[model samples]
Target: MEDLILKHVSLEHPANQQSHETEGLSSKHLVVRRGEPFRVTLFFQGRLFNPDRDSLVFRAQLGGLLVKFPATFSKPQSYSQWNAEIEPGKSVRSQSVTVTILAPAFSPIGLYELCLHILTQPRQYSYRIGEFVLLYNPWCPADSVYLQTEDLREEYVKSDVGFLYMGTSKNVIPRPWEFGQYEEGILEICLDLLKISPQHRRNWQKDYLCRSDPVYLSRVVCAMINCEDDRGILKGNWSGVFKNGVSPSEWSGSADILKLWAESKFSPVHYGQCWVFAAVMCTVMRVLGIPCRVVTNFNSAHDTNANLVIEEYYDGMGKKLHMSKDSIWNFHVWVECWMARRDLGSGFDGWQVLDPTPQERSGGIFCCGPSPVKGIRDRHLNLIYDVPFVYAEVNADVHTVIVQNGQVLSRSVDKERVGSVICTKSVGSALPQNVTSAYKNTKAVMPSNRSTDGSPRSRRSYANREEKHTLALSMSLDKTPIAGETISFTVTVTNKENSPKILKEHINAQAKEYNSSPLETFWEVHNLLRLAPYEVKTTVHHITHSEYDEMLLGDGLMNLAVVMQDTGSYERVLVTEEFNITNPLISISMTGNDYVVKNEKREARFLFRNPFHIPMSGVLTVMGAGLLHKKVHSNVSLQPGEIMEEKISFTPKAAGTKMLHANLVFKNRPMVIRGFTTVLVRAT
Candidate 1:
C-alpha cells in the first residue's frame, strides 16, 4: 500500500476563508454555484519524485482563458531532487504541488466550465505530465452536517429476541401454500360474503381482522377460494384477472396454478393486493387440507429517524418508523402454517408470521376492526426554518409519517428538537433462540374444513423479560396555540422485549417553572396491553390551549417533562422539552431603485438595490392593464442587500401613459409599488 505523502501544497484565491469549503477535485460528484469566487490548491506526494530543472508550470481552463503559474518544488520535506544524482537505497519520499484560481469575474449564473491541469516531470526524466480534475461546491454546504445513528452497545448484537419460531417440516408443513382444507373453507366463506355483499366484502375482512373474529377469518379464506378471480374483494370490482377478466370463483385456485397463471398469457396474481392474494393462497391450502394464518407488524415502528429513510437503508436501527401511537405495531406480517405433529417439524413448531404486510400492523389483537382509539399523532417540522413542529403555540398539532418501500413504517411526534437516538437491538439479531410451546393440536379438521391439521404440532412459548435502553429523547410541541384553542401531546413507548406487557406511568409534566410543578400532571397514562415485546404504546393528552399558555408564560419559557415507565419495575427514561412563543413581525421600507419611471418610447435600464436585511426569494413582475408584460424571478435563496438589475422595453400608443406597477412577490405574497411616468408622443 502506498501511503499518501505530501511534499508541497498551496492555496491561490482572492480570499483565504473561501478555501475552507473546497471538496477536492477528484470527488466524482462535484457541486458548485455560479458567480461564487473560489480558490484551488495543488498537492503531490510520493516516494519517487524527480523535478524538471528547466521549468515547472501550473495551468487551468476556466471558461475560455488558460491561466498559468510558475511551479516550484524547492521546499522538500523528505527529499531533495534538485540534483540529477539518484539514490539507490532510499526512495524519493514526498512531493507536493498546489495552485488556486479565482472564479472568473464574468462567469455566468449557471453551471460554469472549468478544469485543473497539473504539469510536472517524470520520476527519472524531466518529461512533464499533465492531469485534469473537477471542482464545485453545493450552495450553503455546511462545515458540519450530522449523520444520525442510534446509541447501542456492541453486546446488543448478542442479545436474543423472543418470537414464535416454528420448525420447518416438508410432510407436515404442506408443500403448497394453497390447497389446505381449512384455508379452502375460509375462502368459501369469503366467497359467500362476496356474493351477498360484494361491495363491502373487503371492509368486512378488514373489520373482521380488527375484531380478531375467527369466523370472519374463516370467511376470508373461503372467499379467496370461491370468489370470482377477477373480483378484488377490496375494490369489489370484477376486473380482468391478469389480462382477461374472470370472476373470483374462476380465479386461479392453486398457488402453483396462480404462478403458472401469472406466467400465462392471461390471469395472474398481479390482479390483487398481496394480502388478498395471501388470503387466496390460505384459502386454497385449506381447500386442499393445509392450514395457515396471516401475521403482521411494523418493521421499524418508532425506531428509526429521517436520515435512515433519506439514505434508504437501515443505519444500525430498524426501518424508519413514523412517530405515532400505533407506529410500532405495523412492522411485520406473514403466514403461520400448520400441518401434523411429526409433520410439525422441529425448530419450526411455533406459530410464525411469514409474509410481511405493506405497512406495519398494530401490536394489539385488533386485527380487523375500526381503530378504536385515535392513536398517536405524528408530528413534523422543517429543521432548516427552525419552525416548531406545531403551527400554533397553544394548539400546535403535527402529524409525521415515516415511510419506506412504499409502506408506512412508523410514526412519532416532535415533542422537542428530537435529540439523541437510542439504538435498540438489531432486528436481524433479535430472532429468538429458546423455543417454548404455547399450544398443542387438540382437534383435527372436519371433512368440511379442509384446513391442514396442526393436531400434531405444538405452539411455541415466550419469556417475559425487561430490557432497558437510555434514549436521549428530544420532545417538542407544535407552535403555541391561541388562548381559545386546545393543545395536545402524545407520547409513545416502545417495548424491546418479546412477550406482551404494559407500559407503566411515570413523570409526564408541563410547568411554567421547573421547580414548582410536580412531575406528573401532563397526562393520564394507561397501559393498553401487555404490549408484545417489540411493541409500542402511545398515550395522548388534550389540555385547554389557554391552560398551556398560562403555564408556558407563567415563567416566560415553557418546560415540559416527559417520561416512559415500565409498569413492572417503574423503571423510566425522563426527558425535558422547552419552547418559547414569540411573534416578532418586522416591516421595512426601501430606497434607490424602489420606484421606477419608464418612458413609453424609450428603453430603460434599471438597477434595483436590495435594502432588506435578510435574504429572500421573490419575483418581479411588470403589470399593465390586464396583461402581464414581463416577469423575472430570483432563485429560492437570496442574501441581504444583494443588488440586481432589470431592463424593460415599451412603446406608448397615446400622449398619456399610466403608472407601471413593479410588484415583488415572496412566498406567493405580493408587495406592490406604483409610479406614474409622463409620456409625450408626436404624431408621425
Candidate 2:
C-alpha cells in the first residue's frame, strides 16, 4: 500500500452534466441531476489495485452534513441508497480506475463536496476530489418532481418567457414576464436564496438535508419570497404609496429584482405585490429545476376567519365600506408546483399550491403553502400546511351587506362571486387556459345554477335578477374608461308591471382598493325617474376628471351604484358596477435593425399621448435582460392631446429570447403606464 502513488483524478463533468441535463445550471462546477449516476475516474502510478486488501469510502458533504458510504468492487444495480461502485474490471486495473457514484432520488439538491478515503497498512489517506451541484430531475421517473411529458417540462421548466394573467375575469389581460432563469447572475442568486433563508441561518445542515424533498423546498422558497418573517427576497407593498421604493408595477421581470437583492447582500427588494411575488417565485423554481406555473384566481377570496365566508359591507347608496377585514380581490396570483405528495395519502399527488404573498401565517410563519390542490378541492380540512385556508380562498361564499349607519338594509349571499375563474398560461402560447374545473366543480351545476363564463349575456343575467319590485334596474359603463378623462356611465330603469310608476334614483360613486373595501364617496346625484306603462328609459351622466380624479389617484378603482325606489309602493332596487380606470398605454417600437443581434447596439422608441385636458409630466424607466445591462430612465412633459416619443439605446448582452419593458410613472400624479416588447436576439 505504501508503494501506491496517486497522480490525477477525473470527475467527467461534461458527460455527467449532459446525461443529467444540467448543462444550463452553471459553468463553474460539475452539475448533475440527482437520482442519476456520474462517473469519477482516477489516474495514478501505482501497483495493481486490490479491492479485498484496500477499503474505500466516499464522503459527500453539504454544509455541516457529511455522509460516508462504502464503495463496492462490482457494477451498481440498486439505487435505493447513496452508493458507489468501481467499474467491474477497473477495480483490478494497474494504472487508471473508474467509479460510478449515485445520489439517491431523495438526496438534497445543492452543492456538495466529494472526498475519497483509502484505508490500508494501519493508516487512512483522504483526498479532496471535487465539488458538484445536484438538482431535481423532472426527466427521472423515480424522482418526485418528475413530469411525464416533454412538452409540459419544456413549458413549465425550460421556458424563460411567460405571461401573467391579470385584470377582471371578463376581460383577462396577459402581462409579459421574463423568467430569466438562464440569464447572468440569476441562477447564482436563486441558489443564494436557499442559503440566505432563516432555516439556513439557524441550521444549514438540517435545511440542506430537507431540500431532498420538493415539498420541503417549495415551502422554504414560499417563505423566503416574502421578507416578513425572514430577511428574504421581496418586501410586499399593497398600499398605494411607493415613496421610498420601486413600485411593484414598475417591475417586469425577476432577474432585475433577484439581481438587486443579491447585489444588496440579500436585503429585501423594495416592493412586490401578489403577481410580482408569484412571477419571481416561478423564476426561482425553474432555475432550481422544478416544474412550476403562475396561476390567477379572479374574485379571489381572502377570508380572515377560516369560516369559508367573506363578509362585505356597503352603504345604502352602494358605496363599499371597510368594515370587515376579509376581502375579495379582483384577481390574486400564486404558483403551483408539480410534485408527488408522498406524505399525504393517495390522490394528493400533483400540482400543489405555493403562494408567496404575505397574506396569512401558516404554523406561525408567513408562508402559505405547499398546500395540496387535491386536498383543497376535496375539502380535506385535516390535511396539513393550510389546506383549509386555500380551500376558502377559492370556495368561500360572499355575504354582501348594505348597511345604513348601524342598521343592515340589504343582505345577500353570493356563492358564485368568489373564484369565478382560475387560469394559467396555455402551453406554448400566450393564451389563458381555464383551470377552474381543477379546483372545484363547475358552478353551473351548483344550486345557483350559475356559470363561470365571462360572456356579456351571462354577466347581465348574473347582475340583474328578477325582483318582485315594480322597477327593473341595471347599470353599465359607457366605454372602457381611462384615467385623466371624463367618467361616464348609464343606468336603465324599466317598468315591469302594467301600471305606471314614479321612482327616485340615487346615483353614487366611491373609490376603493383592489381587494379592500371602498373609502368615502366622491360623488352622488339624485333624480326623479318616471316610467309609463311598459316603458324602459336610460339616462347617462358624466363625472369630469376633477370630480373623481382624486379617487383614481390611488389604485384607479371606483364603484357606481343606483338605487331606484317606487313612489307608490315604496319598493327599492339597487344595481351597482365596479370598474377600474386603466392608465394610458406607452406603445413601444423597435428601430435601427430588422433583427436584434447579440453584442450590438439597438434602439427602442416609446410613444405616449396625453389624453387629458391638463398637462402631464412623468419619468420613463426601461429595462431588459440580455438586452440592457441596467435600467434607463428619462423625464418628459406633454400638453393636452400631445404625443411624446423617447428613444433609448442599449447593446445586447447575450443571445436568447428577451423582453424590453417600459414604464412611465407620472411625477405629479398617481399613475403608471406599462408596456413590453419581445426581442429574439441572434447569436453572433
Among these predictions, the greatest lDDT belongs to 2
Indicate the residue-level lDDT of 311 in model 2: 84
TM-score of decoy 2:
0.88
Which residue pairs in model 2 clash with each other?
Answer: none
Give each model's whole-structure lDDT: 0.29, 0.81
Residue 125, candidate 1: Cα error in Å is: 75
Worst 10 residues of 2 by lDDT: 454-463
Candidate 2 lDDT tens digits, 1-684 = 444555778898789987887665676778788888899987766565566576778999987788898888765567878899888765575567788899988889888899988776666678888998888989889999999999899899988888998766655667778888867667778888899888888888789889998998998899999999997899988777777888887677898889899888888998999999999999999888889999999889999878899987766665667788888887899999999999997999989999999998988889888988888888888998889888898999977666787986655567787888899998877678888888987742111112245312222212233234566677766666777778777777889889888888888888876666666888999888888998999898999998887667445777677777787886666666666777777898998767989888888898988987778898888878678777888988989999989988989876766778887778767777778887889998
- RMSD list, candidates in order: 32.6, 4.0
Taking all chains together, each candidate's TM-score versus the true structure is 0.19, 0.88
- The segments of candidate 1 whose C-alpha lies over 4 angstroms from its true place after superposition are 1-467, 470-484, 512-530, 554-556, 582-684
Tell me the deviation in Å of residue 188 in model 1.
94
